[model samples]
Target chain A: MEPIAVISIFVLAVFVGFEVVSKVSSTLHTPLMSGANAIHGVILVGAIIVADHSSTNLELGLAVAAIVLATINMVGGFVVTDRMLEMFKGKK
Target chain B: MSRTLYDLIGLAAGVAFILALKGLSHPKTARRGNMIGAFGATLATIVVFFFVVAPKTGVAHALPLHHLGWILGAMAVGLAIGVPAARKVQMTQMPQLVALFNGVGGGAAALVAIVEYLHLGSGATKAEVIFTVFTVIVGCVSFSGSIITFMKLQELMTTRPVIFPAGRFIIAATLVSVIGVGGWVVAALGTTPLLILAGLSLLFGVLFVLPVGGADVPIVISLLNAFTGLTVAASGYVLDSVLLIIAGTLVGASGTILTRLMAEAMGRSLFGTLFGAFTAKPQAATGAAEERPVRSGSPDDVAILLNYARRVVIVPGFGLAVAQAQHTVRELADLMISKGIDVAYGIHPVAGRMPGHMNVLLAEANVPYDQLEEMDEINPTFSQTDVAIVIGANDVVNPAAENTPGCPIYGMPILQVANAANVIFLKRSMRPGFAGIENELLYDPKTMLLFGDAKASLTKVVSALKAL
Candidate 1:
């Protein structure tokens, strides 16, 4: 199969996925985002795995870079979110 | 083996995940949505790693072992920080957390593009450089802007708009110069110099958002979230990653829509959000003492009013989220229901901190979804309501948002709680809300202020209702 065809299939799937999420009521967004964020951590793991398996220097470097960036995003996201949640605590 | 079949399966999983997330919009179904999203992400990772990269490498190694350690270590660190932080943080700070998360996502996506550019060595093609530049700028801005938002929300930074004599021009000039230098670096020096340029762009991003007032944080957060999506999409282009492109675009589009909605809710222009423009302040400190006259109500008087009201609407705000009083409120609602009075909850979109905050609190109390109504759906009914019992909420139900011209919250959509025959405000004190503005509803002739801890106050109200 052509790469374009594979990519197109994936893109279509994402669109369908978005449509499904949009239909969800507003009440669920916070939990959904929170849970989905945890899953983004997997992106870091994937990048590291990719970096470890790379035969070429270029691929390895790219993988390493991806790993660092993904990790920052995943960890940073949770920290900021936790701090924000603190504002609502202990009110009258 | 037919790769097409794998792609089809991956696509199906992605679709399923999106639908699951949507279904999760209600608190009851949110957990299921999370499961579905995780499943979909797993499938995506498997497809990308095992099917695409493995086949490309064809038995040859694709990455180093240390790279793998970095990923695992990052995850470990993230969990270490995230778990305890989440456990300790209260619900009021959720919006800032969300903004911070969105920033991180954008920053990560940008970093991916930067690394890719660096790997291209000295002489990259024009197209490669352009995409790299786009990713870096967007990602940096998103990251820095989001961090500043976190600072503001955490009260680490001033909530008031921070402005200087030439703040706007300086920001604009800096952005233009950064882009110019970025283009030169990409065109001549390649990716190495681009890193420095990216740093400058990030600084500009921070400065851009810092001048904005706290009242505009929600809009700014939403906008930054969209920027993150765009950055991810750009990263996809650099990596030739289909999944990233798809996911990023979805987030980008939806985030844009949400941002616009938030701006409209606040009755602010999109241009105002972009330029950090806000009305100049009156400078007078309007404390609770200076707010409109507060008519205090004793528990017995409130009980008498609650006992006779045929219908009631309870409006919960950040105060309720702070007190974690959903359970007590639910008990109160139940007690009222036993008296044959119809009780419903009115939820404002911007209530609490993030969207759906009130719903989350109520769901925790096991309140039925049907009993919760949005601002618009419940506003008209408030006029007919015998009692509008406000619980720990302020800005969302403030009469000023509806009637006070030139007020900060004026023109912002709000629940018409003031229209009710009798209003009861349950607050610890006469503190201003998140916007730092007075709630005129408190001073209304018919309004009664019952000051105390929300949980304790609700408990008293519940017992009084039962006794009555």
Candidate 2:
């Protein structure tokens, strides 16, 4: 239940993640990034959950800020990506 | 009680997800790779939520009902919008779609940093405050920069770079001032002034990308994606979240590498990418003289040229990708090969909007990888080539890259297809390429312009070759 143990676990996960990603060829990168970007929404969820649980005002404010900024990033990113996708439509 | 075991599992899953994504790069196994990646991600998310968050933080606080509702609600909204939009979008739109998604990641990271700042109030530690400030700045820039790139790519705004009289200077000053003020605020007052700084950065993002034309969008998007990754990593640092840090760093590093590669392919420096200016003029000004060129050829003539040539090289461009002519091109290549002619593909690094665009299309057509030669390899061969067939290619083969000074794409690398014995350019019209400049290759004496839809033109060329 120690914080260090928890942190270590997460760190280990990330190291593994990096090893896997490094091997991806250029061709697969765009789609991989796209999928990863969507998965990043997990961060928004995590931040909001953490923020809402804050017993103190400082924690509460930090959490809310995280939620709002994370939400904006997630939503805005998807919108822009969609718009980019529109450019190649209907070309003969 | 066995947190170590769970952690190991989580790490393994994350690694698996990454490997699966890497495998998805080739078309042959892309679908399976996608499935594997999805499975890995789902597993990692579940494990993190359950073992890491629940047991340590305790179940009561970890799965707060209201928070769970919000998570579900967000998912609902995301799926509602994302699923339909993704389904309706054509493949050509994938790049812009990626930009939009990257922006969201950046924005989310910024929001997380803000939340951390607000939580600190007056009693926050120096480390917390510093992490928070860094995350906000990087996150805001990534978010806003991505939005600008999206607009440029989508044609909602001009694809041409928007340069004011003193645009570059203004952008520089704004960036300097923002950094100065932001550093002072973070060093002295902490998160209190960060909101203002974030606003400034958002503006800076728009200004930075506005002057860059559509031709450079892929590079811009790649750069922004890198920013998003770095910002996310910084946010991870703020929250002391190990997974966030790892994920962010991976994205940041990979995105950066890709950006650099893209810039190199375009023969552009990172510095040039930031300050490049574009203005949309009618393609006619660039297309005009080419239309009147005497060498414009019909399919029959092109076919005759192809029939007689001992060797042929097909040069593909964004136009081919736009027309989705890989299969047709493949058929044409096959037919040519059957006729005892040596056929090879000349791929320019920056041929399409992204790196390897031409290769991806060719691969889809089941073309052998060895036959697809990069610009360097193919350029030398073009001189000996009996016939060079350009399929919807423009900027990459345009001689202007080598000869035109004071032009935006000047000094950028291009395929030297002009040196071939015979050249055939397939185009919808003589429209200027993404660079918003005329293609001098169109007027080359050896070049024969074939005007029409690329697929249609290729089909005719095939039939004509058959008759010949």
Candidate 3:
């Protein structure tokens, strides 16, 4: 990727990130934070990508561990956020 | 998969994430928004198995989709552990659980960066090396900082701010060394320098979270969440994945905004919450040991006050969550509503360890949404209420937040329950709140105390109200 392209994407995403959650109610703060926590779990892609190329035993071991941890962060995060939001769904 | 197709799918995943975040900001769309985020993340992870980042020339490092068995098995293990933990965790413990998960995510980002850095070796471009160093440092800090927060929230450690002599200088020096070593790694590009950088960052993370008292842990957690997001973005740059970059940046952006908003809601400066303890004035010793006479009342007295009140505001705090008394409080609220008393719950933004935590717990106990009023909404209504019942809560209702300048909790917004015609507190003991500051409202002449476990007291009050 070009440096200019990466910078452009980075700057634009920052504005989008700021714009999305600016109006959220405090009632949903926990879930929103948790949900954002889960979104970063997408770093699992970086883990898997690095794990695929690990030529040595040490590198492979660390990458695999990263994979496991990222999965937990992602899967567990969404599930918990859902559980938190479950109560809101049940509200009449 | 062809490179074009792969990049196209990645773009789609990124767009899905934006929509997910947008959906989560509104009440009606939150659950479905989370579902969309889950879907997008799953899609991205699975797509990795099919497509690969093109390897640069002479880099025989990663064969396409290598170690497929290990990757699948590891994910399964993650699933086995994550599902039950998320499902079975009690609502009262949600804050710690969130902290724990955030830590692991951060750890994962750091590990991924390390592996990628080693794989790149000296062949990495200057920009790539800088991003790798950034990822490694921030990820490590976020990882360890989150663990400290988890311990504090779990009561595995003291919840009070840990301030030692010259603590500010020590923290500042650690931060300086972390940067110095980070520069060494970027210039020298060795495994040892990077590893040392990681270690220092981890130390900084622990030290950084230690001085934050319990009441402000939520803000720290949110800020660390942003740190982890930036790490993911750095990792995305290292791996050259637009999906990772966009998703990470979004979290980074949103987490930063959310942290600021939570601080504003609590009437705290962002800098004050993070570094205030270093320069804090030692609060005067509380008179907790003096055994001052408080007007202790029976459950019948609480019941009588509630039975005749035209309007009632119930204030809840961390102790209520600690005692798992959300259900009991809801039962009492329902009972009050049945008696035709105008009932409302004054919910502080920072209530129950995390923002919005009480609302989730109360909702679980079937408390109606409309009855749960946020701090901004309910602060003014207290003056019109006949009885203000505070159940297992202290800091949120403490007037010291407004009156005392040097108290740890001073300047934080508090429920103005003092304006009510009567104040009733059901507390376990006379101990000060999490900030280790005494609450003057408790000693008010109009305040009535009913001491016991929150659940038991609420139950007794429910029965007393029933007898009426």
Candidate 4:
């Protein structure tokens, strides 16, 4: 990927991020935050890539732990956020 | 999959996340939004095993990756631990649970960066090394800072601000050392400087969270969440993963917005919240709190007040959640409504342990959404309210926020319960609220205090109201 392309993606994403959650009420702040948290768990891709190519024992071990932690972050984050939003059933 | 196809799938996943954030913001679309996000994440994670990023120039190298079994087993281990914990966590413990998840994500990002750095060795580009250094420091800081927040919310440590002597100076020094060490890592590559950089970042993280307490906690958590997002972005740049960069940057941007909104809702400035301990005056008046005379009342007295009021407003707080009295409180609200009293709940923006936490608890107990009024909506109605029942809450209703100068909670907004004709507090004791500040409302002439567990007192009041 070109440096210019990456920078363009980052800059465009920032505007989108601000616009999307701007209208959310305080009532949904927790879920919104947790959802965003889970998205970053996409870091697992980077972890797997690193772990796949790790040549040394130390590197492999650390990368493996990263995978585990990233999994928990992504999985727990989404599940917990879902549990929270479930309680926000529409008014009876 | 070919590289172009893989990148295109990653683009689709990024689009899913955008929809997820957009959906999670509103109550009507929340659940579906979450599912969409989960789908995208699953897609991204599964797609990774099909190809790998070549170490030197960020090219796609076809899989199968080495240690394939280890990666699968590790992910399995993560699932085993994460699923049950998320499933079993009580609503009251949700904040700390979120904190814990955030911490691990940050730690993972840090570890991943370290591996990439070591794998690249001296072949790492100057730009890549700088990104690695950024990820290492911010990731470690977020990891450790979140742990302290976890401990604070879980009651493993005191919830009050843990300010120490010359705390600001120490915090400043740590910041300097972290940056200094970071510069060293970028200037010359070595395992030692990187490890030292990680250590200093962890220490800075702890020092950073120690002085933040009270309603400001959620703000810190949100800020750290943002920190982790940026760290992931830096890691993306280091690994040359376009998918990671997009997802991480989006989170970083949205988390920053959320943090700002949280601070604004609490009537606080982010700068003040982070440094208020050093600049604000110490609360030296708590000792005098025990000596003040409060109008101690019986459950019967509380019942009489509620029964007579034409309009009643209930203010729920952390204490309500602590006693797990949401259902009982709802019952009392139903009883009042049946009596033809205008009943509504006064929910502070920063009520309970976090923003919107009380709503989750109340919603869990099946309270109607229409009856729950946010701080701005309910603030004006208090003057017209005949009886204001404050159940296990303090700081949100405290007057010190408006009247006092130099107190820790002075600039924060609070409920105007003092304007009500009668104010009733059902409390456990004379202890101050979570911010460790005394409430002057308890000493007001029109105020009444009922001493007991919030649930028990509400139950007794219900029976008395029934008898009446």
The candidate that wins on TM-score is 4
**Best-to-worst ranking by DockQ:** 3, 4, 1, 2
**Candidate 4: pairs in clash:** none
> Which 10-residue window in model 1 chain B sums to the lowest lDDT?
B55-64
Clashes of 3: 1
- The residue-by-residue lDDT of candidate 1 on B406-461, one tens digit each, is 66666778888888999999999887787777876788899998999998888888
Instruction: State chain A's TM-score for model 3.
Output: 0.97
Q: How far is each candidate from the true structure, as Cα RMSD in Å?
A: 5.3, 5.8, 1.5, 1.3
Cα lDDT tens digits for candidate 4, B1-468: 777988888899999999999998888998999999999999999898886767784454556877999999999999999999999999999889888899999999999999999988898988889899889898999999999999998889998888899888999999999999999998889999999999999999999999987568889999999889888888888877777888898899999999999998888899999988778877675776779788999999999988999999999998998999999999999998999999999999878788888888899999999999988899999889999999999999989999998877887889899999999998999988888888899999999999999999999999999999
Task: State interface RMSD in Å for all models.
Answer: 5.7, 6.1, 0.8, 0.9
How many clashes does each candidate structure show, in the order listed?
Answer: 26, 27, 1, 0
Model 1 regions more than 4 Å off = A1-25, A28-46, A49-92, B1-31, B46-66, B79-92, B262-269, B274-276, B279-292
Give lDDT tens digits, candidate 2, residues B226-311.
67776766666565455566556656655666677667768888777776563322233543565565478899999889888899
Per-model DockQ against the true two-chain complex: 0.25, 0.21, 0.86, 0.86
The docking quality of candidate 1, as DockQ, is: 0.25
What local lDDT does model 1 show for residue B144? 93
Whole-model lDDT per candidate: 0.67, 0.67, 0.89, 0.90
Which stretch of 10 consecutive residues in model 3 chain B shows the poorest summed lDDT?
B55-64
Task: List TM-score per model, in order.
Answer: 0.82, 0.81, 0.97, 0.98
